[model samples]
Target: MPWTPPLEADALTTLLSKVQQWTPFDGNALLDDVGAVLDDVVPPKEDLDVLAQRLRGHLMQLVNIAVTAEAGDKDPEADRLIRQAHTVRAEAMPDDHRRAVGHLRRLGWTVNELLERLVAANCLREAA
Candidate 1:
């Protein structure tokens, strides 16, 4: 399983509720073109904070769609993908900018895979 941040009881409960209530038209799914999310995390801004936030937000987007689609009954692979995003988020990044960018890029690919899966499942319209 992909490692996720430890969830508090309340947060877990809320996620469960949202999952239970999700529909194909659910607002919880991330329908944005998230492809450029890390475009800024290049040479000038690969600092710890910048990369961390981007990573978190990226994972959140992946997780949101996966969970929502799972609820919609359109995808059973959601759980594994969600876990993979969690794993990427929990890993430590190197202090070197190049290494950091590489780490973030790995997660970026994971995010792209989730987006692709969502599209295949008919949960998201492909952005032009």
Candidate 2:
């Protein structure tokens, strides 16, 4: 049997719930993507804050790279949303896991979408 580390209730709930919603990918493709992103990302019992920060940092960096690769000024509204998500992620909230997952949920749109909207929004902002 493969060893599975314990995960926080809320984080586990969020991950499983999101995975359950993905129907387009056959078999384990969706799970594979999720696994790829979360592989070895076990958070110590008292270090949820650090884990949340690291996850958000990855998302923020992807968003920055996507936004910066565009020509001309970015759209104010799309930029605002991405910035808002970034701001929400910067705080050290008590429900750090839930809040971080929630931000990902809102930002990504679907289980496999994963930052696509933020990138699209940034591109649209540049086009606007």
Candidate 3:
């Protein structure tokens, strides 16, 4: 079946073509902030909601960049990023603070990995 995107077809095509440059998404700062928060074995869950929201956005962008770069289907690393993005999207915010903390921490790790893979694929502005 042909699936429809939320965006209009022509608009989405143009936007995705530009996404190949992987700009407007700061992987360095994102890595730093996520690292700082997850540095502790158990980070406070108070900010999990905000962090998760940001991470979700970043993951989605990463997936789009991967697709634009022609990495999503054939490359193993991009495939991993796509799968992880799907996982996070399917997940819900954990009610228990501890679980929430754990989930965010894991997402932190995933984002870090995705950035590395993207850099290696020459998708980002600079090596991450």
Candidate 4:
């Protein structure tokens, strides 16, 4: 059966394309701010490494949030971001690369819909 998307075709297309660039590793903005502060201080390698580790820790803390299924009462925008982040992170999985695919399916995105677009995008070698 042909499945209809929750969004208009164009919007869904845009979303699929954008999701490729999304990251579950959050805190990039804060990391940039930390980088700016470090720039002013002319930090040594050890200091910079420490800063990077701290930022990575913060990002790891957010990883679970990114993969969490959206609550029925959650804000739509926030859910969208989390799902996108999860989708991007799914690429790193070994055996089950489609965890985010299942997540999106539960959220009303059909497997065929995603697969059609993904296959058209050449399975990630070239971003859609």
TM-score, each model?
A: 0.56, 0.37, 0.73, 0.26
What is candidate 1's lDDT per residue for 1-128, written digit by digit as tens?
99795469988888889889654432232323233445663645435556466556756765776676573355457566677888887888777777777776777677767667767777676633
Candidate ranking under lDDT, highest first, comes to 3, 1, 2, 4
What is residue 83's positional error in candidate 4, in angstroms? Answer: 10
Which residue pairs of candidate 1 clash?
Answer: 2-83
In candidate 2, what are the lDDT values of residues 1-128, reduced to their tens digit?
99784578988898889779643322243334334335455334455444444445544554554467541145564555556656655655555665554444343332223244543554422211
Q: Please report, in order, the local distance difference test score of every candidate based on alpha carbons.
A: 0.63, 0.47, 0.75, 0.39
In model 2, the worst 10-residue window by lDDT is 25-34
Counting clashing residue pairs in each candidate, in order, gives 1, 1, 0, 0
TM-score of 4: 0.26
Report RMSD (Å) for each prediction in the order shown: 9.4, 16.7, 7.0, 17.4
- How many pairs of residues collide in model 1? 1
Who is ahead in lDDT, 1 or 2? 1
Q: RMSD in angstroms, candidate 2? A: 16.7
Model 1, residue 70: C-alpha shift (Å):
0.9
The runs of at least 3 residues in candidate 2 whose Cα sits more than 4 Å from the true structure, single-residue gaps closed, are: 1-47, 71-77, 95-114, 118-128
Off by over 4 Å in 4: 1-39, 69-128
